[model samples]
Target: MASIRAEDLRIEFPLYHFARSMKKRLLGVASRRVKEDPQNRVVISALSDLNFTIESGERVALVGHNGAGKTTLLRTLAGIYEPVGGRLTVDGEIGCLIDPAAGMDGLSTGRDNIRLRGLYRGLDAAQIAALEADAGEFSGLGEFLDVPIHGYSAGMSIRLAFAVATAFQPQILLMDEWFSAGDADFMAKAQTRLEQLVKASEILVIATHDMDVVKRWCNRVIRLEAGRIVGDEVV
Candidate 1:
């Protein structure tokens, strides 16, 4: 079954510009959120002492103010970032919608990126063909699919990326937020696709500021502050 567990999980980003002496001075004045690691590098703790478990069949929302580490936690769960301390365990296939352009190459054609993604995922030729078809149809990119991604508009890129990312079913779905940059028709279609994926997936972890969305789609809420989980409750 799909599940996620965080045991005192911590994620930190080092500040490369700080000199050793400056880092020491900053560390001395820093709150718990900033510190010098064992290697004496100055780092900002993006997630601190996070402990939570999400079992299969759960829809969890990560809510917090800006810079509260919502996206950081989502990236960590997506394996885009590694924790500097503690442990995080995720069981099952993970699909991430944290960044629309993630895993996509700006210089490559949309079709090329789609094929590369399929190959990277170990999909067979038939599966890759299906993925390409799905992305082509759902993205509405048509002739533009053969065009380099850099030539597409922001909305076009988002549409293509969303289509490709959601083409395959996943055991765990991690979404930062629903894309609003798409036009009305595309947004409606994307919503439908998201609902279908949420229903099919064993676990859904979304970081969103829309409480209305959380109430409508999620069963649980996890509130964070300064990278620390302050509240965890079932709705």
Candidate 2:
């Protein structure tokens, strides 16, 4: 079963003060006059005292204003970021795209990225071979799949990333505002593919500012403000 639970999970990015200086925030050294007293640890609390449950087969939409920990929450679910306090539990295989280009090497060809991404996702040689075939279907990279991703245009790169990310069948899916960025024709096809993929997944947690998407795709909605959940409601 694919399930996710966050028990009072807290995520903080520890920002250490190298030197007590106003300009210490940037990499460049700051003059002593502007420096603040060096502190051991300074933490920016991204998500504080967060608790939520996403059961298998649940479709959830996370809504929030900017800087409200929506992206941070998704990262924790994808196991990309560890919580500072509390624990997060996720069951079954998980495939997520916090950033669409996370796994694809820019210098590698689209075809190479497809195989590489599959391998990175824990797929074996045979399994990657199978997904390689599907890669051509999901992505319209055309002959560019054989060329280095660096040579592709922005749209081309995004297409390749989407193809590679969706090749793996995951019990839990995490997406961050990536499903509808292309042209209308591509959007239609991609939406159809997303619907296809969503049908098979046990759970999906999406973070986006688009309320229409939340209304259409998510059965439940979570609203966050200032890194805290303000409301959890069923739509």
Candidate 3:
């Protein structure tokens, strides 16, 4: 039952700023404004008329240049962003690795973060407790889990985050880019786990600029430009 469908999907961001001067008002007046108001607010379209359908067991790669809305689209699919127009339907449990520290607290200990992230993912206290030990061991943080994440290095932080993020396999996996963290050995381990997750998940959507990874891991490639899908090809 895992599937995703977008029909003429559109996402826009409204930039709001106070009208400071007559010049600014005039400039805003000349430009596209939200609701045609005198206020200095302009809406920038992130995704326009995007249409696609992804069924179960598809590994899809979103390939695009910077500012091409790949991350925005992924966020939309992850239910983090609401569309401004059109329709989007996503059916399944979604796990996203959009940013390594997205739902983590640096002021808290790694163990605390594991609990918090599990809660965010809708796991109950008992479920979170059960996963805590395995997540801790998988992160390779050992006693460092008791220390505040602020004291951890970038690699250490990502290791813990990745471990927590992947502890529960999701039906739909969304990744913004390839994860690169930890030492050489740790990265190798992480990569193996990532590949396993991608394979086991019902659907995988990854946004990355690396063509080799797209070719190797994805069954389909979606090329985006200026908030629109320009090409879609089966690998």
Candidate 4:
């Protein structure tokens, strides 16, 4: 079953220096000794007591302005960041592409990164080999897969990322923005395959500021502002 539940989730960044500075403010010790690291900066409140639940086969779009905590929430849900408070539960195979290049090693060749991502996503060697062959059709970086990924142009990296991400259908697929890349001609070809992923995936949660995408792709939508949910409704 594809399900997600988050209960009173609270995420916070620690303020070691901010706390210490409070004491300095009281004690009147004016010294620059605390400039050792940036961790002394004020702690940030990323997510504040958020609560939500989604049953099997539901689609939701996260809509928010830049830095309104959409990515932080998604990253928390993807288990990349541990919530400081609250409980979250997910039942499904989650495929996340929040950061297209998160797992890639720039020094590695595209071919190696493909295999690495496949393996990290839990596919065995035999299954990865089959998927690798199809990756070529979509990646379009012909002959460059063996070249270091650091040298790939932005378009080429996006192409390779899309290919690797859509190599398999997922139960719960998460995306930040549907990347727009490739030449106009290549994009047309890639669009068909990208759409194929949307059709085959069982559940999806996409984060975007694009209102048009939220309308077209999500049956339900939630809008966030300043780390709080300002609106939510079914489209």
Q: Which number leads on lDDT?
A: 1
State candidate 1's TM-score: 0.93
Lowest-sum lDDT 10-residue window in model 2: 29-38
lDDT of 2 by residue, 32-126 (tens): 11222236354566887888888987899999888888999998888889987898998877878678788678888888888887777778898
Q: Which candidate is the best by TM-score?
A: 1
Candidate 1 per-residue lDDT over residues 6-78, each given as its tens digit: 9999899989965677777887794987887888777888999999999999999999999999999998998
Better of 3 and 4 by TM-score: 3
RMSD of each: 1.7, 4.8, 2.9, 5.3
lDDT of 2: 0.79
- Candidate that beats the other on lDDT, 1 or 3, i.e. the better one: 1
For candidate 4, the 10 contiguous residues with the lowest summed lDDT are 31-40
TM-score of every prediction relative to native: 0.93, 0.88, 0.90, 0.85
Per candidate, the number of residue pairs that clash is 0, 7, 0, 0
Ranking by TM-score: 1, 3, 2, 4
Write model 4 residue lDDT over 113-179, tens digit each, in one string.
9989888878888988987888866788889999999999988898888888878787888888857
